[model samples]
Target: MYRILIVDDEPMIRKGLQKLVEQSELPIESLRTAENGVVALQRIGEERPDFLFTDIRMPKMDGLELCARVAEMDADIQVVVISGFGDFEYAQKCVSYGVKEYLLKPVNIKGFQNVLEKLIRTKTKVSSETFVAVTKLEQWASRMEHAVWMLQEAELKGLISEILEELQAYKLKLNRVIDILQEIHTLLHQRLNVRDVYLMQGELELTGAADEQEAWCRFTAAVHGHLEELRAKRKGKLKDPVEEAKQYIETHLAEEVSLEEVADFIGLNPSYFSQLFKQSTQETFVQYRTRRRMEKAKKLLEQPQWRITDISGEVGYADHPHFTKTFKKYEGCLPSEYRQQMGIRT
Candidate 1:
C-alpha cells in the first residue's frame, strides 16, 4: 500500500491531488494533504510517507528546503517536485536534494498517472527489497511513549534497541538519529517534574559518537542511567511517611481502608495526608485506593485456582455483584471475562 503526501500553498491543488489519487487505480493506503512544508514536516515526523509531492514555492518553508531536510531525515522517500514554467530553474536545483521527478503546473491526469505509475514501480521494488510498514513505525512511537511513561527499564532498553535497528535499516544520518533521540528525551522530560534530566552536553554527548554502533550504545546507556536516577529519586528516603503510607495501602488492600485511617496511622492529620498523597502520587486518596484495589484484583484473577468471588473479597469487595460491576468498570471486562482472556481455565 502506498502512502503519499501532497504539499501545496493552494488549497485547490492539494485537494485536487488527493481527489485524483483517490479516484486512481493506484494501491494507495492513505493520502495526506498539507498547506506547506512546515505541516508536511510534522506529518513526516509522525510517519514518513512513501512518496512526497510538493510545490516549489510555499509560505513558511519552501519545497527546496523541505527536500533538503527530507534528504537528511529519510533517503528512502520518493520526492516529486511541482513547479510552474517560471520556477523551472529552482525546481531543477531540487534534483540535487534527491527529488525524483518534476511536475509542471496545470497538472494533467495522463501525466500524473504516468509519473505516479513510475514511482509505484520504484516503491514496489524498494518494498520487495526491505519493506517496513507505516503501522509498524507508528507502533514504535506508541510503545516508546508507554515505556517512558511507566519507567519500565527493560522495556525501554528493548524499545531503544528496536528503534536503533529501524534507523539503521533506513540508513538515517547521524544528525537525524540525534534528533530522534532528542525528541524521546523531550517526551520523557515533559512527563517527569525533573528538569534537564536527559542526556545533555558535557554529561553524555551523542554528537561525539564515533560510529553508528557507538552512537546507539552511548544514547541507550545515557538514557538508562538517567532513568535509574529518576527511579531512585522517586523511591525517596526509606522512612518517608509517603512511602510508609504506600506500604500500608499495599499491606491492607484486602481490608476496607479509608483516608482517615491511613492518615492517622501515618501520624498526620487527614487534610494534610490527603494533600500530600495527591502531590506525591498524582492522584486523590479515593482514586489511589480504587486503583490499587483493582490492580490486586487483576493479579489474583491470573491464578486459575482463585475463584472470582474469592478474588473479589481478597481485593476488598464484599458483594459479588458490586465486585463484577467495579471490575467491569475498571477493566472494560467482567472478572470472568478477564480471566478467560488471560487464558486461565476455571
Candidate 2:
C-alpha cells in the first residue's frame, strides 16, 4: 500500500485533504500531514511517503522548493501540487519540477480521483512491462549457459539451424555470439570433462542461431559432424597406446595401478610406455595418473554417503595420511576442505 503526505500551511486545508484521501478507495496504508514546508520535510525524512500532496504557497519553503528538495532526497517519491491560485505560470513551474498533477484551490473531488487513478494505472503498467523484460533476459541467459555446456562436450552435429533461430529470437548480436562460441571452443580444447565439452559445443551451435531452440539443434549437429571427422582421422593414426593407457587407468582407478602394469597390458616396455605416454599426452605418466585419480576422487566426494576415508581408498590411496597430503598437493586443499568449499555434503 502506498503512503501519502499532505503539506499545507492552513490547518483546515490539511485536515480536509487528509480526510478526503483517507476516504478514497486507493490502497493507502498511512496518511500524514504537516502545516508548513519545514514540518513537511521533517515528516518526509521520518516516514518517506510514496506520494506527496502539498500546497504551493507555503512560507519558508514553497511547494515548488519542497518538491525540488524531495527530488534531491528521493526522486522515486511522486509529488502533486495543490494551490488555491490557478496561476498558469505556477502550474507550469510545478510541471517543470516533475510534479505529476496540479490542483487549483478548493479541490474537485472527482477530478482529483481521476488524476490519482491515472497515475496508479500508469505506474502499474510500467512495472509490469519491466518485470516481463527482466524475465525474458533471465531466460535468454539460461539458454546461453546451456549452449556453452554443449559446446564444451564437442557434440555439435545437429544443432546448426536451431542455434541460428535462437540468436534471431533473442536478438543477440552476431559478433558477441561468435565471441562466446570461440571461448567455448578454446575451453573444450583444454581437455575439459565430456559434460563440459558437450555444453561448450552446444553453445557454439547456438551462437550460429537466431533463437535459443535453433541454436541448440545446430549445436547438436555440429557435435555429430565433429565426431565424424575425429573418427575418420582416427582411422589414419596408429593405434593410440595412450588411449589404451587412459582406459586402463579409468578401469583400475581403485587398484594400485602403475605405468608398468599399463605397459604390460599394452605389450610395451615400462620405460618406452612412459616416454610414449608423455609424447602423446604432453604430461608425465605419474602426473596423468594423479590427475585421473583426483578427478575420480572429486566425483566421489559429491556423494554425501561416501566418507573421506572411503573416498581415499576408492581412489586407490591405501594410506589416509598419504591421500590427504597428495590431495592437498594437487588440489591446493585437503579433501575435506575441498568438499566444504564445493558445498558437497561429504
Question: What are the models' TM-scores?
Answer: 0.44, 0.37
**Global lDDT of each candidate:** 0.75, 0.66
Q: How does residue 6 of candidate 1 score in lDDT?
A: 95
RMSD of 2: 19.1
Off by over 4 Å in 2: 129-346
Best by TM-score: 1
Scanning candidate 1 in windows of ten residues, the lowest lDDT window is 193-202
* Model 1 C-alpha lDDT versus the unseen true structure: 0.75
Candidate 1 local lDDT, 1-346, one digit each (tens): 7779999999999888888788777777778988899999887766557789999999999999999988875446899999999999989998888887988998889889889989989877765555445566556656755665467868987888778766778755554455466555554444443444442211345554434666566556555544544444456523666788899999998899999899778665465466557767999987888899999888888888888889888988898899899889989999888888999875
Given candidate 2, what's the lDDT at residue 221? 38
For candidate 2, lDDT tens digit of each residue in 181-284? 44444444334334442322122333324433443444343444344224334355345667978999989988898788998786554654665577679999
- Per-residue error at 7 for model 2, in Å? 0.7
Per-candidate clash tally: 0, 62
